[model samples]
Target: MPAKKAANQPRKSMKIKKGDTVKVIAGTDKGAQGKVISVLREQQRVIVEGVNRVKKHTKVVDAGGRSGKSGGIITTEAPIHVSNVMLVEGDGVTRVGFRRDEVTKRRSDGSTYTAHRSVRVSRSTGEEI
Candidate 1:
């Protein structure tokens, strides 16, 4: 038997999504802003462009007998906790809020319908994020 999907499911990770611009609120990268490149749900971390860089030492290896090279320092992106970041709005930093927009009915022939859509917006600016 397989697990069943429920009518309503709670997300385990942060609400931030890729392509969203975020500012680091705490840590060494505080005040730094960048676009979200990826999200690590299990670790509760996020990778932002040009943020949380760490040097990694690696040795070059040969697969088929080419050669084994010397080790060197390589800079790479490190994971940062999602709680240290905040979504930036037009005016300032703010949390994400959901709002539902009531759809207006439009009749082409003789049909009537209503649709409701939810959208995320910035609490500070009250604008769509």
Candidate 2:
């Protein structure tokens, strides 16, 4: 018999965003790199292009008494856990880092202030992403 597993696990917040190129760090697709197509925030999973491809047998339900229909195996991407992927920076994979911009901006009250907007940077080259 299989042992019972933990009923609850904390969901982790993912730093990767849509359109970011990432490399699969774990799982069967390890080392496969692709651009992120979508990020499932609640599930902590990311769908990467050309990664985790799975075949789905889909059928088109028609109104003609199901007489004429087309069904075929279609290949599509499957979502992979966020932890199994790493952000790609430059020609290599790098961890993400946050930094504040040094630019200043004027406030609505006619006062100037330092606008420290957060920016994603590469941990290896320290360059903005």
Candidate 3:
């Protein structure tokens, strides 16, 4: 049997995004800042470049190709909880907020359209991010 979806469930959104600069606010990597490489929405975790690094062990692969390949200990970024990082806007860290665009447009058919587009804004300065 499958689980039922709740009607009152709120949509999930992340303040951080790929290529966004962020500062770690907690955990061992605290005080570290880097670009967000990936976001794990289902896990509520994010992988920041140069943050939360972990070592991986692997075995050497078959060297049947043109170049020989060998696997060893590899260090890579691990997922960190999204709540532990803050978006970096300019010189400081700031919370993210969404704002809708106010401009209206007309279609080729001449019908008016006012679709609102959400934008990320800095919480401290209220500036567009």
Candidate 4:
């Protein structure tokens, strides 16, 4: 029963990582692509550069604690749903798939080993990414 329960656990997290290139698949940013700048695991959101821009009101800093300093509006990138983005391939234009590599068998005296490898494949050209 324990073994079956362990297998039913939800996935660890999303496969996407920081600095990874991703393409927007949904929303107003559809077809837009950019490098992943940040990931919000708690909210399941990602902020891609130049993807979602929003205005922020922030207090302006004074150089010498002067009262003349004034606050102004600032524009910045906002977090977007992670589901809208897809991992981009090496070519920088297509999405890719991840696959585990097959392990090789080895025997010496009394030993067994297994190796795991993952690679991305371009969905457009059917080539390794």
Candidate 5:
């Protein structure tokens, strides 16, 4: 059987998007800022450009017919929990908010319809992000 949906269930989404500048507020990398590379929605974690780096050691594999990649210790950015980072607005970081804007949209038959679109806004300055 399929699972039932909650009537009052809120929208599930991450405010910080790719290319957004964010600052680490907690953990060992606190105060470090970088662009958002990816968001792991299921894990509720985000991979920043230069934050939470980890080193991985791998074994080298050789292929006789084709070129193979050399294995060594490589450093890579790791995902950080969403709660540990804050979105950067200007010189400081601000909480994110959502607002609904009335928009005019067209349909497949060339009919126009009015709809409310949700947009992310900066809570501090009340400006769109």
Candidate 6:
């Protein structure tokens, strides 16, 4: 018999966004750092460039008689659990925090209004990420 894996925590807004550099903290690709290619919000997974590479054997597809697609073993990145990675700030990884700031917004009526927007911040340096 095999043991069951622990269930992931409830999904929340991910601090890491596409194009952000992150370092893998756990799993097979641990210690690897790369730019985030995509973020899977529902699944709580993130695909990082050059990390979690997997090979897929795809079959060729043909549509009608004019165009067709070539298929073969293709190497690509796979999604890694968000918890396994940390946001890279400056020369090291930093935990993400959120700060709400008041900002002036303009409406269609040409009136200005003050609004509070949430911004991601670096916990270590207390600076926006």
lDDT of 6 by residue, 61-102 (tens): 765565667788999999999999999988999999999999
TM-score for candidate 6, please give it: 0.84
What is candidate 6's CA lDDT for residue 19? Answer: 96
* Alpha-carbon deviation at 72 in model 6, angstroms: 1.6
Model 2 C-alpha lDDT per residue in residues 24-75, reported as the tens digit of each score: 9999999999999999987789999999999999977664764777667999
- Each candidate's number of clashing pairs is 0, 0, 0, 0, 0, 0
Best by lDDT: 6
lDDT of 3: 0.90
Model 6: per-residue Cα lDDT at residue 70: 71
| lDDT score, candidate 3, position 33 | 94
**lDDT (tens digit, per residue) of candidate 3 on 41-73:** 877899999998899998989787787897899
Write the residue-wise lDDT of candidate 1 on 1-129 in tens digits.
Answer: 999867576757467889989999999989999999999986789999988999998876654555546567999889899999998776468998888988867799878789898788777777777
When summed lDDT is taken over every stretch of 10 residues in candidate 4, the lowest stretch is 1-10
Tell me the lDDT of candidate 1: 0.85
Can you give the lDDT of residue 47 in candidate 4? 94
| Residues 47-104, model 5: lDDT tens digits | 9998999999988877556677678899999999999999998899999999999999
Pairwise lDDT winner, candidates 1 and 2: 2
Candidate 4's C-alpha runs over 4 A off are 1-11, 61-70, 90-98, 102-129
Task: Sort every candidate by TM-score, greatest first.
Answer: 5, 3, 6, 2, 1, 4
Which should have the higher TM-score, number 3 or number 6? 3
Q: Candidate 5, residue 61: CA error in Å?
A: 0.7
**Candidate 1, residue 116: CA error in Å?**
3.1
lDDT (0 to 1) per candidate: 0.85, 0.89, 0.90, 0.80, 0.92, 0.93
Q: Indicate the residue-level lDDT of 38 in model 2.
A: 99
| Residue ranges of candidate 5 with Cα displaced over 4 Å | 1-11, 65-69
